[model samples]
Target: MNDLVERFEVAFNQIHQHLKEFNGYPKNDNFVELLQRSKLKHSVIRVHFDLLKQYAKLRNALVHERIRDDYYIATPHLEVVESLEHIKQTLDQPPEALEFATHPVIFFKDTSLLTEIMTAFDQQGVSQFPIYSKDNEFLGLLTNDGIVRWIARSVDNNVVNLAGVTAKDVLQDGLNPSIEFLSSHGTVYELEERFERSLEEERKLKAVILTESGKANDAPLGIVTTWDLIKVDRRNEDE
Candidate 1:
């Protein structure tokens, strides 16, 4: 059986390593606190924090749970180990999904209410969104997590109260959401290098929006995610 403690250690170490990649401060006396200083995109930073908290909880379970074969108690440990490897590889993998989810890409009009966006997010497990105008003009990208940060900061920013502030205001104002372009055609390895290099400077590693043109202002044809890549990797490993 896979040792949960060791697996947890690996999980924490991987998370820590990825965090360092995204956290761009000069240096820090403590590592965990370093994330607070990440210069990455607002939404990417938020994803990092959420991932961190989840791994911490998994680590706690690994440390506290007792394993037994009699009742198949080891399954959870194996599952977690699988998940740990999955998450680590997703963040650390090369660009694009090896076999990304064909889950129909979700979006909202620039003029629509946040509730519509909220509904899309809730339904599709929206990791991020590519904002678009009425003419299908690419506005900017936004992550569901970015919305939470916007809410938290809007009170202090005072932009929330402005009546005329449009979706473009909430989007293009300053909440730099990370974005990636789908390769018109190329090796995923080539894309991975770019993605990793992008994160090396800060936390905002924009996702590669798979599209027909893979060119600017082109309509998005599909989506890919780190999680999708990780799952593909795990499946490959099993095979």
Candidate 2:
């Protein structure tokens, strides 16, 4: 009872502090106002606003009214405490974790000429390229490193038909391009878990490609790289 109340208060205060830090507002702002402002900035909070408001009322009751000496009037139910904890965790997550990617992704067809591919790479400054088949099936990724390796092998073999060679011809066996497909609505936690699992399995994950339905054949909506996750984490820490 008392312990649950204390935990609830702690969680509530944590949420309050997070809101203050995020909004860069004075502590003089009321909790409800801060929450309302947060809803405007975070879609997660907007989705859970009603429940949070109810929890705020409960917290107030637990803290304000006293039924006996040295005891508060209300003891928060276990469910309320759990809800507060969940909200706190959600709020603690960085905004980038929930942000949807919108950057343009450069891709190529496996049959595309190596000359054309290099031209696109030079013009776009893209290092990673998702290669697909003519029917729009995802074949594999064509990274700059892969291109360099293929060029070295071609030079060793005294082959000079670089313009005539296709991306499929230069495809190296056993390079093991690491890519994953995720839905546009997929959560950041899901993205993090996939990356973590790949690391645990000692597999190099290069990109997490987002699609409408998380299918390989679907057109990519966005892409996430290891660097993107690192940047997001760093930004969260700075905030």
Q: Which candidate number has the best TM-score?
A: 2
Q: What lDDT would candidate 1 get against the real structure?
A: 0.59
Model 2 regions lying over 4 Å from their true place: 1-102, 157-159, 172-174
Q: Write the residue-wise lDDT of candidate 2 on 1-239 in tens digits.
A: 78897899899999888778656777567888888876655545566778789888888887777676568877888987897787788667534332645366778887899889998889988787888889999888888888887777667457656767888886644453789988877776567656766877899898888887889998877888777776545443343
Task: List TM-score per model, in order.
Answer: 0.51, 0.62
**Candidate 1 on 76-107: residue-level lDDT in tens?**
45666676676567556533432454445665
Provide C-alpha RMSD values for all models, in order: 13.0, 11.5
How far is 178's C-alpha from truth in model 2 (Å)? 1.5
Give the least accurate 10-residue stretch of model 2, judged by summed lDDT: 93-102
Q: What is the lDDT of residue 208 in candidate 2?
A: 87
Lowest summed lDDT over 10 consecutive residues: which window, candidate 1? 38-47
Candidate 1 Cα outliers beyond 4 Å, as residue runs: 1-98, 156-166
